[model samples]
Target: MTANNELFILSASHTREKLKQLRRTHQFFCPQCKEELQLRIGEIVVPHFAHKKDSNCPQLFSDGESKEHLIGKQQLYCFFENKGLTVQLEPFIKNLSQRPDLLVTTKNEQYAIEFQCSNIPIEVVQARTKGYLNASIVPIWLLKTPNFKQQKPTRIQLVQISPFRQQFITRHPQHGSTLLTYNPTTAKFIYFSHLLFIHGYRFIAKVQQLPIAHQYFPFLHLKEPTKEEFTHYWRFHLHIRQRFLRQRFYLSRKGVQDLLLKGCYGARMRLDQLPLFIGLPVRNAQYIDVYIAEWQATLLFFLQDCQISILQVDDEVIAIFILNNPDYFQDERGKDAILHYILLLKKLGVRSIHSSTKEAIILQLLHSEFLAKCYEN
Candidate 1:
């Protein structure tokens, strides 16, 4: 909450500068609870209203706002104001009992914009979003931009998407899936879209940054990647996939039965000899909470256990695997990842489905020139 800039009511809002000068002559009260508020002015911190030590406000409470949050909210409010949109800072809604950082109104719809700069539980985000949606108001959550040492926004980059960050991921009709972040110091907005989930906590995202002054209300969507760009992405994906497998083998304890390595040994296959289709990217694979290769290998091992081929794979097999290995999946829908992976396997195995031996299939399917080049280096 940007306490410095919240309104006396929905109609009357005060700036920090106004609050600073008015502190000597006037008193302020919370907009929601109507309790007397102490105007806190400081040299380092921004001028804002604070509840006295003993005061209690049921509608809202001070969470000790950070300077970054205060400034960011203020800037966003002004940015929306400059666009001639009806915007309110920290409007306390009666029905939802939620104080959105900025309540924006357009001709036909309302939106609750939360400029989240601090780490909060995902449950809080979910509840707030649910509240807004239940009230027929859309929720837009923008996080603080992370510090990227040498970020190249033009191309795909490996970014750490922590659990907290994952809560902000949203889908736009035009943008597909996107996460928006703002940098107050630079006055720029970073858009992360077309997320390609690599593994745990890491993603290959298409990143772009726009100056706040040039930004528009209905944010611009990142264009889909071209064939050349996708080729480069797959090359990078292959590189990271190999690197991840090597790290797993190297990092596993000597005495521990490593799932991936053990599966490979049991199948009489080397890491390099594994099918190219095993670790290929699948939609929603990230929700499985396991390495793409590891889980995909598990699917193959399961098929061997059932004495079946890819064509024989069905809902029963998938259900049984999911039931037995519940830890790999993060949610119920995570089972879809296995199904999607099987679909991809079936597509790849169209030519090799009738092959007699697993070794023969592996040898026969090494025909993708692109994949061959990717794995060779």
Candidate 2:
């Protein structure tokens, strides 16, 4: 990661300043390794710092900060600085033994904003996140613009999504949770939230953007999905499911994927006949790869207009009957397969209520599509 120069350099006081004098007199040092640095204030390129010679410092050993990275970082500094907020560039914490790119303090909170221009290990991210947490500082990571890819008008898939990146997902008021990214060049914040998990490393989010200087949202506040918006997203997802049902070869054969394929085909089931309750959204659905169709089909044949013993119809029975593999689930592995839908069914007058009903459940497959139309109206 060899770059000829950098936008700013650190001094003994850890201050970043522009070139004012014709000839340099201040002794600037490398921020990463504490080695002495050389300054180049040329006309063609912006003023920057370079290593002495043939240095191999871990921090400096990156793909070298690009022009976008440098300008983006400086602009981020300006973002807080313009608001008359007290901000520091590369503030070093002795106790934590870490230096964040920018640190700011409000009336009651301290924030460490890291403008991550390059990819780094999730462990490093977690370690730094933990350090900031231990020091009572909130760490906000703003990914570069290139990382957020817009696949379609309504679909924005975040690039390089690992388990660690998934941790960065936070709740937006209307949307359940969102992955946020900032475009330093445009001076705008992009909100990629309201995700519908398709597969591993693949999700489509409702895309919305706002300028950084927005009066109401000085801080990030992505728009929450409205009733109309949520329905539109759900309907689009249904279309996707329709396409998948037509040709299921795109999916990898692993875990319960084959089970879903075999069970649906074996049942001679039509996707149109599937109940809305079958694919009820769950918060932790991302943890398991089982599609909504897989587990939902397990409950289809079991439902009748009769009161049944709840204990006998557990996750194991469902897994065995549908998947032909009872050993797949243990410790209530797929207990949630129908929990929410069952609860909603009762709520929606699809089941008769009984006082002190604990051991038995009365289930009847109400025409869910017709009910969905009624609900939609």
Best candidate (score: TM-score): 1
Per-residue C-alpha lDDT of model 2 across residues 1-377, encoded as one tens digit per residue: 11323424322223334454522545656656776666655554444566767877545521246656666666677767777777777767878888787888777788998877667888899999999999999998877655434334553332345665665776544435667777777877777665655545655566777787772313655454555565555565556556655455445355345655444555565544454444544434444455555444445434331233333455555455445434434334345535544555555444321213221221112223212321110
**Number of backbone-clashing residue pairs for each candidate, in the order shown:** 0, 1
Candidate 2 Cα RMSD after full superposition onto the native fold (Å) = 8.3
Report the poorest 10 consecutive residues by lDDT, candidate 1: 368-377
Off by over 4 Å in 2: 1-27, 30-35, 40-47, 54-63, 147-164, 172-175, 215-218, 249-268, 271-273, 299-338, 348-377
Against the true structure, what is each candidate's TM-score? Answer: 0.80, 0.70
After best superposition, candidate 2 residue 331: deviation in angstroms? 10
Residue pairs with backbone atoms closer than 3 Å in model 2 (clashes)? 174-224
For candidate 1, list the clashing residue pairs, or say none: none
- Which lDDT tens digits does candidate 1 get at residues 154-263? 66667788878887787654445678899987889998776767777877777788899999987667786555666566666778878877777667785336666776
Instruction: Write down the worst ten-residue block by lDDT for model 2.
Output: 358-367
